[model samples]
Target: MVLAAACTALGLWQLDRRDQAAATVSTVQANYDREPIAYDPSLFDTYEESREWMPVEMTGTYDSANQRIVRNRPLNGRPGYEVLVPLRLQDGTAVVINRGWLPIGNREAGHPDEVPQAPEGEVTVTARIRPGEPVLNRSAPEGQLASIDLAGYGAQLDYPMHAAAYGLLASESPAPATTPVAPAKPAIDLGPHLSYSMQWFAFGVLLFVGFGYAVRQQYRLDHEDELDAPAPVRTRRRPSSEEEEDAILDARGL
Candidate 1:
């Protein structure tokens, strides 16, 4: 019974995970390729979960002096980092832009060999909105971040920053001669959570079914032995030696 209860709990947990994954997939499907809208300070001042993956366009100049690289970002199984440059918009407020992924360098142990530069002058950028990640306890070298914690990154900058969200680069006008590899689209696959939940549920049910089968077999075996037993037999007492002698004399006289 204890094991069955545990299995049921685990099954429900997996189902919850499946529901979350489904919601993520639905969000991506709904917003990933929608028409890009102009960046609105009012609408984007605070991060919204539903606005994630929605494309937004803006004109800004890249602030390369304060650019930073996010450490420990891997792409296609290769160790790498992501380049982040603050884009100064027309109204003086800046938004952090994640340009793309860079491979680890050979000359340096933890740094990238070369980081592709963002366009120098004012350029139009189309990017998908992504909420800022939570700060990690780990530390990184100078000019590198442990994660895309926008608030922490904003604190480092001297200008006003939109710390609520960051942009995943979609396209830029007047592209640079060389550019970092673009990030791949989010996978809409619903993973194995559903199947795993079903397996756990089946295990819980089978536990009771097996217990009942064992109980029925035990009862049958116990009753069968009792029903097949032989009945008790009666015995006559043996005659005494004197009785035997008297019976012999009587038989002769007869």
Candidate 2:
């Protein structure tokens, strides 16, 4: 029973993982299907989690003077960083744009002197809305961050930022000659998790069945022992011939 319960718990865990993966796939698909919309800063104030990954377009000027690097973002198994430059929107408020990843080649000697710079001048950016990254324990060097915590970045920039949303650059006009590749959509494949869940459940069933068989075999063995056990020996008491003769002589003498 204990073994079966453990297997069942594992099955449930796998099932939960499967569900989470499916939800992610569905969300990605939905985001891909929706038409690109204008990125209105006004809408960000009421942004919902569901709106994440929504395609958006905006016209803004990159604040090339003040750039940041989202550190430790790897690309294609290569150590890399993401360039984040604030875009000054028409409304005067700024939104951070993740310009994508650039490989950090064996920087044992120090990073490249020539950074991949964003295109200058007014540009139209086609991107997906993304939330600020969660905070972590590590502190970052100035102009470099562990994650894209836009609010934290905004605080450093001494400006009020579009608090609710940031952009992942899908493409831009007059794109930078050395622009990094755009962030790709996550693979939509519902992984082997579902099958794994089923396998776990099967294991649980098999464990229960095997346990029952073992108990049955033990019971059968005990029954067989009883059937093969030796029976109690019968005891009989009979007088010897001499004793019988003595008894008859005594009766005759009396």
Candidate 3:
């Protein structure tokens, strides 16, 4: 019973995970390629989960001085860093932009080989909305960050910032001489959670089925043992002495 309960709980947990994954896939499908809207500062005042991956356009200049490299970001199985630069909009509010990925450097142990610079001067950028990442509480070298914790990044900046969310660069006009590898699109696969949930549920059922089968087999064996046992034997009583003597006299006379 304990094992069955545990299996059932695991199945339910997997189902919950499946639902969450499905929700993410739905969001990507709904927003990934939708028409780009002009950047609205109020839209980011409190980040909306449903708006993730929604494209927005804005005219801004990259603040290269406060640019940060996010450590431990890997792409296509190679270790790398993500280049993050603040894009100062016309309204004086800034939003962090993840330009792309850069491979780790051979000369330096932790730094990237070369970070492609963002285009200089005023430019128009099309970027996908992304919520700020949580702080990992991990440390990184100078000029680098452990995670895309926008709030923490904003704290280091000298100007006001939209810390609730950031942007995944889609495109920029007046392109730079070179750019890092672009981020890959989000996978729509629902993963193996559904199958895993079914397995766990089946296991729970099989536990009881196996237990019942063993019980039935035991009962049948006990019944067969009783039927195979021999029956009790009956004994005859000895004849009386008087009756025996009369029989002997009659035989002598004859």
Candidate 4:
């Protein structure tokens, strides 16, 4: 009875989790697929609001001269570096674009400065919305640019200024030379988790039933031993032969 109740409860709990996950995925998909918006800093009230999959369009020119290569970025599961160039918007707002990965070019060859600098002209940039990195114990290296402290950087930019900067960008300019064309978000299914939850519940139920069966079997074995035990033997020592013969003679006549 207890095992059945536990399994039923667990199965119900997984169902609830499945519902919640589906709801969350639906909300996110809806937001991402909603109307496209031009990059307006004021549209975002907080970092969390901006850290989502929304289409962002901006009219900006890349400042290629100030480009920096962020080391250790992986794309398509391959190790490479991302080209980081600043985007100078029409309203004079500066946003960093994380252009896609490129091979670490040879320093001796002119390829050392391999990625091209953005030409000084107006260009359009479209990318997914994201937030600035949070403050943490680790710090970026120095000399190439100022140390990377997200909070401090945001403070320097002034809260009301530019919105959040994302960690990755598909460069949309330089005539397909440097721009990365963004791909649609991949579809993810959560069905396996629900199934796993059911499996765990079943295992938990079996635990209870198996334990009860084992205990009952042990009790039966102990009871049977007590009921079928052999009668205790009354073992006695034998008398000496000479003593036995003398007792026989006295009984006969003497």
Using lDDT as the measure, what is the rank order of every candidate, best first? 1, 3, 2, 4
Q: What is the lDDT of residue 87 in candidate 2?
A: 88
Give model 1's TM-score versus the native structure. Answer: 0.86
Q: Which ten residues in a row have the lowest lDDT in candidate 2?
A: 105-114
Measured over all alpha carbons after superposition, the RMSD of each candidate to the real structure, in angstroms, is 7.3, 7.4, 6.2, 11.0
Clashes of each: 0, 0, 0, 3
Writing each residue's lDDT as its tens digit, candidate 4 over 39-117 gives 8764332455534656667777776665665554455675545565666766766666656556545663312246654
Superposed by TM-score, candidate 3 places the C-alpha of residue 84 at a distance from the truth, in angstroms, of 0.2
Ranking by TM-score: 3, 1, 2, 4
lDDT per residue, candidate 2, 1-254, as tens digits? 78778888998998899888888787788886588898777655555766778888889899988898777887778777788899888888888888887777565332433467888899998888877777777976666888887667888776667767788888889877887766677787888988888888899899878888999999989899787889999998898999899999999995
Best by TM-score: 3
**lDDT for each residue of candidate 3 in 1-254, tens digit (9 for 90 to 100):** 99999999999999999999999999999999999999999656679979999999999999999999999999989999999999999999899999999999999899987888889999999999999889997899899999999989999998999988898999999888899899889999889999999999999999999999999988889898677779878988887998889889989994
lDDT of 1 by residue, 1-254 (tens): 99999999999999999999999999999999999999998535788878899999999999999999999998989989999999999999999999999999999898999999899999999999998899999999999999999989989988899988899999999888988899999999999999999999999999999999999989989899777789879899899999999999999995
How many residue-pair clashes does candidate 3 contain? 0
lDDT of each: 0.93, 0.80, 0.92, 0.59
Candidate 1: residue pairs that collide: none
Q: Model 4, residue 159: displacement in angstroms?
A: 12
What TM-score, computed on C-alpha atoms, does each candidate reach?
0.86, 0.80, 0.86, 0.62
What candidate 4 gets wrong by more than 4 Å, as runs, is 1-24, 31-35, 48-51, 103-113, 142-176, 180-184, 226-254
lDDT of predicted model 3: 0.92
